[model samples]
Target: MQGSLSEDRRAQGEASAGLIRGELEKVREEGGSGAYGVFGEQRIAAALKRLGCGKEHGVYIGNGFYSVHTGVVCVSGYVTKDELTSEVHGAYAEPQPGTGPCVENRGGH
Candidate 1:
């Protein structure tokens, strides 16, 4: 069961990469004539990478950066339920969408 979960995560990551790439392409196709801050695609990539999605997952940009958790929340702050679910579903088989708490490791020696 654990192995299946891992595989599912990997697959999810790959799918996420595909969806993100498509969205980016759409944005590019639309063409912009102004400066831009980090946006949804960037944020999504950051979050997915932080969640253990690797480069092979296709979430990394040419600059070799992934979506940090903060980036995710920033881009998705205005997401609707249907949109959020659709986007998240592209990755995980389960709707476990969230940047779970991050705990620091302390030495216990």
Candidate 2:
């Protein structure tokens, strides 16, 4: 059972990697500013979940810029559990002032 689970996780990771690669290809083909929006982020998060990455896994969307044009937009983040936790915690610790409340609190008041 353990071996099977490991194999499943591996397969999921591979599939996720492929999906991410496809997104990257699209961004490249569209000249970087292709507008991945939340689509790529959701894909990465789903892939991580499938691979049993847990909340400690961080999924980052990175964009590069060049002269008068956007460069490649890709996943420049790591898949390590520790790094993921750090990334998430760091983001939470930072204050986004002037953003006008959190998304969850928008409709409360």
For each candidate in turn, the TM-score is 0.30, 0.30
Candidate 2: which pairs clash? none
Q: Rate the local accuracy (lDDT) of all candidates.
A: 0.33, 0.30
lDDT of 1 by residue, 1-109 (tens): 0112255555654565455445444444444313333334454454455545544432333222233122122111212112222222222222122322111112233
Q: Cα RMSD (Å) between model 2 and the true structure? A: 14.4
TM-score of 1: 0.30
**Which ranges of candidate 2 are over 4 A from the true structure?**
1-5, 32-57, 62-109
Question: Of the candidates shown, which would achieve the greatest lDDT relative to the real structure?
Answer: 1
Find the candidate with the highest TM-score and give its number. Answer: 2
Clashing pairs in 1: 45-67, 46-66, 46-67, 46-68, 47-67
User: What's the lDDT of the predicted structure labeled candidate 1?
Assistant: 0.33
Kindly report which residue stretches of model 1 are placed more than 4 angstroms away from their true locations once superposed.
1-5, 36-109
